[model samples]
Target: MSKQRDYVLRTIEERRVKFVRLWFTDVAGALKSVALSPAEVEAAFTEGIGFDGSAIEGLTRAYESDLIAIPDPSTFKLLPWRGETEPTASMFCDIHTPNGEPSVADPRNVLKRTLESAADMGFKFFTHPEIEFYLFKSKEFGPDGPIPVDRAGYFDNVPGGTAHDFRRESVNMLEELGISVEFSHHEAGPGQNEIDLRYADALTTADNIMMFRSVVKEVAIAQGVHATFMPKPLAGQPGSGMHTHLSLFEGDTNAFFDPSAKYQMSVTARRFVAGLLKHAPEITAVTNQYVNSYKRLWGGDEAPSFVSWGHNNRSALVRVPLYKPGKGNAARIEYRAMDTAVNPYLGFSVLLAAGLKGIREEYELPPEAEENIWELSQGERRVMGFDPLPQSLEHALAVMERSELVAETLGEQVFAYLLRDSRQEVEAYRRQVTQFELKTMLDTI
Candidate 1:
């Protein structure tokens, strides 16, 4: 710990970093930061920086508002978007109460706690996310929604395209900050793009996700465009989803892999997938979390609506990608329901909890959907026990409210606050008349 702190201090001085940003996230996964002068960072590393926690949603109330942020030196990185002459650096912080206990309401801590539980079970959780978003002309919109910057479809390489240039710059900035991006390409949506980050431990992946979103937004603003992670930004186009690939490791071995098993999926992996299928509905509110998210889930441009898994079907909620001839470690389950708009920390926490529970309880893996679930009739799906995921934020919240796994995993304060805050959002949205409604029904009414 001392060596890491010394390294951070030395780097700050060597790089002449003008400001040090202490970063953390609110319970809802919004990034929060406090900038400190170089001289103050050393003391902050020891005593921590105090702030008003009540200002952040789901953190604290007025009566007990004080919180401290302790910088994790290992996360220290120079901000690539910030000027280089007098550079800015940032480090992720762990939120603590004044007495130095970890805050249950901290999203990062929530993930860390979940990771610890996984560690106790002799496993490590890893995630690789193919994050998708749209580059828009601007933030403003008319009767029609925001215009996409390009009309390029999936995998199209438009020469000198706006999205192309934007992705290059964003990937460059991310690499500068030491985030490993495995792949980037145009997605199915007109202006939507996807960047797949290489797999990392769950907690580090969550931190990288926060940084990834920031970098994308910063690059977009620099290029005089807007980037949105809104799950369903356009009505007719395919929606953006994170489409996370998840796996569990024991020691150095991929616990999900077995040479003799079907699809090379081991018992552990089967139970894990079963757990995810069983609890996916309950975790949807945390993973999707917005009214707009439901539009993507049920929108049906290959987005998953039913709770099923398969090796070849993209319509299934969970997908097992074809195993490579020599790559057993690459064996993983891709969870397709989660969108990029999620708070990765809370989302991963609930996901790990669900999977672990399945393993512990020896959950029975169900039959694969094998066929295109979207092409199936409602009766056929029901007959196969292919239960649909919660179709709306309202329905998702109701399902989540009854989830013991979610409640216990998120802890009391965060779980309660998320439910309360989300219900209020639902009610507020219910009262509003959307542009579609106004355009379609105003004259008819």
Candidate 2:
């Protein structure tokens, strides 16, 4: 066996891990897993474990259903929530065909393909995601609506509070599983919370994001509450967002930073930002995938609604956070349009692809909007050359349909599937009779 595979085997034996769960995500970012005893580990590493791909969403048609999942030994981690008596571990897997060809339908492989393009350009993509979510009183909702676990808002320290204890326990569990957290705090919305993961390479960060969600839900369930990553779970409340910070590195040096340039942003950084702004509308469907996601985008609760970049404007889609003194390595751009509900693999892939296109084609960065974009009128915004993001899921999908960049980034299989899926969603939503219509139109119209 290779040394890395040997190490995993030894670690499992030493830890007395009885079950090793092989985990992978579907195209929609749903977590799926299969458990294996230690006896299957060696063979799995070499030959891979076969599964019916047709059973998975967007994976395959029923006829060509056979697929293999090869566990990535590097991602092995002991599940902290499991008991010591019968310890369980987990590892992320990459899906492939029986013939050993990479599955284009696999979201993880799509990201790997995009990262390969970055590797060719002598740049490495790194990301730090500030993920926000809400905690509800119970899993089931009533006529009155699901209740928030606590009323605490934005960094409020609620002494002897459920949320505070939940955050502490959640952070501890994450660290125990080797996911490093940078910060955790209560968000602006009641019951809403945010956790920021430390920056890692794109692939590792995606894996960490998936784990982070699992851990949060696990902890919440144990505490007799429900945690949701839904982008906009409640009306008149701030919606959850991913608010990802991204940077490119050339070997050990930060490629986005230049001390003498305006705002300390290098030429490469400017073009990267330009690319994101230019393509933000086209890629909105993937970043903010759900119908409710558009509710958050247009709700104006610190969620960006326009395609603009600024140094300190939270209302703009892209923001370059001020660089701390002697912390040039921290220079990065934050894309605020994405939500907590997106599939990180595909989202990161499209994002990186857009920025790389900017760098390759030398797209020019637009003038910064230092003022609050939310305060500007439509005419004012138009005069300033600021464009609004898609107002709804249907509009966003229409923009995505014509996007050459998104289509190329996500291979033909995924691209076609997502389009069909999104169209179905819009059609279903159109047929639904909402509560608002019943409340107002029933009596008046």
Candidate 3:
């Protein structure tokens, strides 16, 4: 605390950092911040910022609304996306109850709880998230509705297009923030892009995910474009999904690697994967939380709809990339279903919890899907023991409702809140009149 306090004070004085924002997230993963001036930062480190908790989504009730945000010195980073000039620095915050306990509503804390379980097991979870999102030309509403900026095809590099320069600038900013971008390209859908981040520990990755979203949006707006992480922004095209790559490590050793095992999958890895496959339907509502998320799940080009694992098969829900011969650190499992629209903190926690449950229970993994399950006929799929994932948000909620694992993982507060919120979203969506209905029924009448 003393050293960081000195560093922050030094940075502010030397670099002319005027504001230090304590950043945190709501249950819905929207970043919230409260700025502290240079004069009060030292005291802020000792005494947290007091605010009304009731105002935050999924936070405290109105009557008992006092909450605090304690700055995490370790996450101190200057916001490069803020501007090219005298920049503002920010730190991820820890939400605290009045009595100084970690707030249960904090998504970052939720992941920390799950990480504690992993830490107890003598392992640290590392994650690399391949986050996907869409870009659209800034538009004003006409009589109809919103529209995309361009009609570019998958990976089409339009010469001198505004989106091209926007992506370039976004990548540059991400790199400056120490968030490594392994790959960035246009997605199958027009105006969509995917950027793969190098894997790191779960907490850092979650924090980076938070930063990445803001940076992308900032860059987009600077170039007169709008960026959306909405799972399915367009119809009849592939949707944006954050197919997360996860691994377990024990003191610099990859815990999930064994040369003697089938496909070189260790028992621990198989068990973890098994737990994910088993609990997948239950966590669908969390991984795909939004009402629009279901549209992407069913659109079908790349979004996985079956609970099956494969070696290099992108179609299956989970994939184990064939290990690069000597690349031990890079060997990991990829979970296909999670999207950027989902809250990373809660999403990662639930995922790790499910996988850890498998390891603890020694759950047996099913046979690997050697062939593309999508290519197989319905009867063939049945023969191969492949079952389709939950088909809708309603169906996902039904499965989640019955899942003791998910219930336990999320605990009562979040579990109840998520289920109730999701149901309302589904119902609200169901009530809305759509273009499909109008087009089909109005002409017929």
Residue-level lDDT tens digits of model 3 in 326-362: 7776668999999889889989988999999999999
Query: TM-scores of all models?
Result: 0.99, 0.99, 0.96
Q: Write the per-residue lDDT of candidate 1 for residues 64-165, one digit (tens) a residue.
A: 899999999989999988888779999999999998899989999999999999999999999999999999999989567798899999999998999999
C-alpha positional error of residue 403 in candidate 3 after TM-score superposition, expressed in Å: 2.1
lDDT of each: 0.94, 0.94, 0.86
Point out where model 1 deviates above 4 Å.
none
> For residues 1-445, could you state the per-residue lDDT of candidate 2 as single tens digits?
7788898899889988899999999888999999999889999999999999999989887999999999999999999999698999999999999999999999999999999999999999999999999999997886756799988898999998989999999999999999999999999999999999999999999999999999999999899999999999888899999999999999999999999998899999999999999999999999998888999999878889999999977888999998898898999999999999999999999999999999999999999998899999999999998999999999999999999999999988898888898889899999999988998999998
Clashes of each: 0, 0, 0
Return the lDDT, model 3, position 88: 87
Misplaced by over 4 Å in model 2 are 142-144
Residue 68, model 1: lDDT of 92
TM-score for candidate 1, please give it. 0.99
Model 2 scores worst on lDDT over the 10 consecutive residues at 139-148
